[model samples]
Target: MSTSFSNLSELVTAVKAATDAILTTEPKEVKRIRTGGLPVGTNNQYFTTWDFVNGMIRDHSTCTWYSLLNTFEDERFSLDQCCALVHRFDYTFSNFLRYSGFQEMAVLAAALTKHLPTAKTREEAVKAVRTFLAYLNRLAAWLFHYFPWNIGKHLTYSYTTASIPTPADPDLSRRVHVADGRKVRLTWQPLGICVVATLATKENPELCEDVLRELPFSIIQDHAVVSGESMYAWAPVVSTAPVHVKERQCDAPVGRIRYSQATGNKIIVQYGRVTEDIETPILGEILLQYRDRLGEVGSAVWKSTFETKQIILLTIETVD
Candidate 1:
């Protein structure tokens, strides 16, 4: 005449409420225990008191309480005996405060539930209990990471291939070798340039254009030196000019450019290529050098090449 157990959802809700209540209320008790410190309080009392309380609550909510509810019809345990049994375990609850003690108690709690009166057979009960314990452990790990208290402790970041670009000049043939061993080339130009632009999910197309248009030519010239080549393994050199988007009807270049998401979320002054050579001392013994004449110059560039391309400043945010 074993009693039927509650549905999974109802049981989970009850367990959550009970555990929440115990955890939320224990802060005051913890404060009191801490304040009671030193010789009189002793290391043993300091550790044991709180440990036992938490262990009892966890064990009861997840196991003992559920067992009692389901086994109410079992004649081996009277209602009063069940109540006494719960009380008897209270003294051992503090053992959980010690190293690995809580884990041991959790194991015992699983054992208590494994042999519930309603269990069809011993093997079935053990398997069910093991599965339940595994589920609880997984849930605990998830909650530990997701809870507000653990917010910044274990932060996660994500990136997508489509949003990032390789360091290549739109005017030059851009070749990229993928991790899976494939190389692709992108030929394009800068649509516009901006000193600083906000990067967000929502951006104004016109604003992006205006920012690029307002960028000084000097900045573009400065970035041109480093813009077309990779400085480090993953560094992205900004292009000096906006990359052109091909028109559907005609192959005419649309005034649009693209950008790669910054690596390591850092910024630096970059160089881009210029059609004209600036006045600078030529390196000695360098072959194929041009002086007092205008020719194609190469450097890193940091600005939008097109109205559609965004020159965004980077920022970090946390998500639950």
Candidate 2:
């Protein structure tokens, strides 16, 4: 019972538990972050465990300086490595990408998500580390040329679906059987719809338009012409917890824009760019370069069947 956490999963659980403590302790201060008009953590979309951790690392102010050190000791996640993960959210530091895992074989490049010991051998662990880093650097370069915004800022994913509410009133629609009737809703904060909308307003709006017109209709479900441009590939980020409100995309911090060790940037790029090509649906190529320890999961669950969804990995070779 006294054994320390031996894997990434346990460590992640501890980190989340610590952050949840903060939320439980200070509920109003978090609600105040909405700034009266900024549509975040509102409606059914509440502040997530990742959001608190992300806020702590964004700047020294909210760094949870007291508990963080203890958490570091407990989890054995180095302050440098922790900061490096935060840097991955830095648009200039790590190219925030979106891709269906199986299509890109991202499962092989799980170093970013899984712990190092998950690898079979030291050599494999080392390669996974190298490939993980190479992917970050090269991916940043690719997104810089392809999209207009910084990568997902301190992006933490939301649960696949929100909790289902109970039916006390027992009246919804009469067109269906009472026993079979239930509510249907989708949350998009993690889906990156706002990611696409924000990018549409970038410098070379023409490229986005070109990509839009030629989009394979088979890829999207429900889309719209946003900001007078032809934007596809996603539904807008909306909240459905208590009420419905249009939500804006979250922003990443610019603290460590470029890679630097002297600034205390601790991302150790161990491997060089081993892959030669980048593709939209941007899979297969990048993941092939890494060691397969814990791999990216691409089951039917993660695939987008909608009319428009945020395409995570956009490259010059992206479907045009």
Report the number of backbone clashes for model 1: 40
Write down the TM-score of every candidate. Answer: 0.20, 0.19
Give me the runs in candidate 2 sitting further than 4 Å from their true place.
Answer: 1-105, 110-115, 120-127, 148-320
Number of the top-ranking candidate, with TM-score as the measure: 1
After TM-score superposition, the amount by which residue 146's alpha carbon in candidate 1 deviates from its true location, in angstroms, is 15
What candidate 1 gets wrong by more than 4 Å, as runs, is 1-27, 34-53, 73-320
lDDT of 1 by residue, 1-320 (tens): 11223443333333344333432122233344334432222454544443444344445434543343333435565544543453344335423432322443344443443233344444433333333333332222222211222222255335343433433323423211111111111111242222221221122233223223323211111122123221111011111222222111111111111232111101222122222211111101101122111112112112222121122222111111
lDDT of 2 by residue, 129-220 (tens): 33333222222222112221223324535533232222222222311111211111111223322111112213223323333333321112
